[model samples]
Target: MPDALADALYELIVATRILANEKVLDAFGHVSVRHPLDPQRYFIPRHRAPELAEISDLVELTLDSEPVRPTDFRLYSEKVIHGEIYKARPDVHAVCHHHAHAVLPYAISGQEIVPVFHLGAVMGKVQFWDQRDEFGDTNMLVVKPEEGASLARALGPHWTVLMRRHGATVAGTSLRELTFRTVFTCDNARLQSQAMAHGRVDALSPGEVKLTAAHQLRPPSTNRAWDYWVRQVEKAGLMPARAAAKGASTTAARAKKADAKRAPTKSARKNSVKSKRRR
Candidate 1:
């Protein structure tokens, strides 16, 4: 069996890259996973762009959001978003925060994001969390515990919440679930807006949400979605460049080994020595 923490770190990196490839995250967003063995802590990447996040960039943090060890890489200012949600929701094992452009209009206009299609059923009952309501006026970032806690409260019992004029937070029971929710939420928003323009909008009814939720959101389906996006990301060459280099080196080494094995042995040398002795 793989180490739980190591697996979480790999998934975290892949999720970050997937979000970036899907355009759900630009340079600003982040994703995290609650440590599989240690529920009291979670793992988030240092303050790097989601596309640039690597396994080495991850930092282990307590539920309170402090690093388990000192890090030279700067921590994310909005990590409170992940930590506080983990602290508040024991059932949630993964979190994603993104400034998706398609959903920003809803954040500003006080509109609820609804599932216009099947993939979006995970967005169950989206709520809005406006920082101004409590803080009155600041940078509008969830940099403090109280602010993060307020956001968590806004997300109560829901899988998604819109942060007024900032972005959105998505939670799930696993990394694949969180990735699915984040990507589909953005896709649903774009599709919903386009659908609204054509005619009367029709979102999934509660019954529809209940019926289709499990089929689209669980293991085999979730794994397929994650795998597809990861392949796309890899195809686009968004992963670490060193990976390609390492692959090339490994292939070259294998080729060299094969050539050595196929080459003729130096049996002629012994024959020449025997011939010289005869001379």
Candidate 2:
């Protein structure tokens, strides 16, 4: 594999494991990264638990969410979630779909997820997409292109969108950023819930949201969190094969290089819009 592609796949696997370890994804959710060399394709693991994802488990699919080659491996039924978002948002190179426990109440209750703290600002303005709004409900899985496209339209230019009564999908300009947002978004939800139990929850003001997000979502902050999460995964003995072979020094070097290559541009950062009430 080319260095860029190999690094992307390696980080993708690491992101999957990190999210699983953090409980942002239990068994059903998935994480994917767009092809570094090809805009029309993306890579995600075949049907499996996020914790078990490895480099070999990845399968490339077109933006239409069709497999590039015939494979006996079962694909994710919601793979279209990743593909359609890629088609809709060129600035997004990574996507994560999860039904994390902390975010479930918001999804089920249609409550808005706002920045209750500084780190939570990374989530920007969370959007909402109800399948029933257009499809009038079925199994609730985004298995069809039209379904995924609807979700993508709801996502608009935001970094995260909640699927009503289902889960939330997060997009990022890089795999590390995706992982950072997924984990912290869950943390923010849990915090917000706890705060609500005490008294009125004061979410960050719009100016605070923009300022904090600009500061916290930088490469240095993301790198720090990524290193910490990778260590946690390593301690759990969940590191992917390639990452383990590369060792910490090489892994850190590659991470820096990947960040340099895939870091979000100014336009990409501006893509996150302020939160708007959705019903």
Candidate 2's TM-score: 0.86
Q: How accurate is candidate 1 locally (lDDT)?
A: 0.80
lDDT of 1 at 176: 93
* Local distance difference test values of all predictions, in order: 0.80, 0.84
- Candidate 1 per-residue lDDT over residues 164-231, each given as its tens digit: 99889999999999998888888899999899889888999999998888788879999999889989
lDDT tens per residue, model 2, 1-279? 346876787788889999999999897999999988778778888888989876777776678776654456778888889999999999999999999999999999998888999999999899999999898848989888899999999999999999998999999999988998999999999999999999999999999988999898899999999999999998998887654535433533543464466424333224323211111
**TM-scores of all predicted structures:** 0.85, 0.86
User: When superposed on Cα atoms, how far off is each prediction in RMSD?
Assistant: 17.1, 9.2
What are the runs in model 1 whose C-alpha is more than 4 Å off? 240-279
Model 1: per-residue Cα lDDT at residue 132: 96
Clashes of 2: 0
- The clash numbers for all candidates, in the given order, read 0, 0
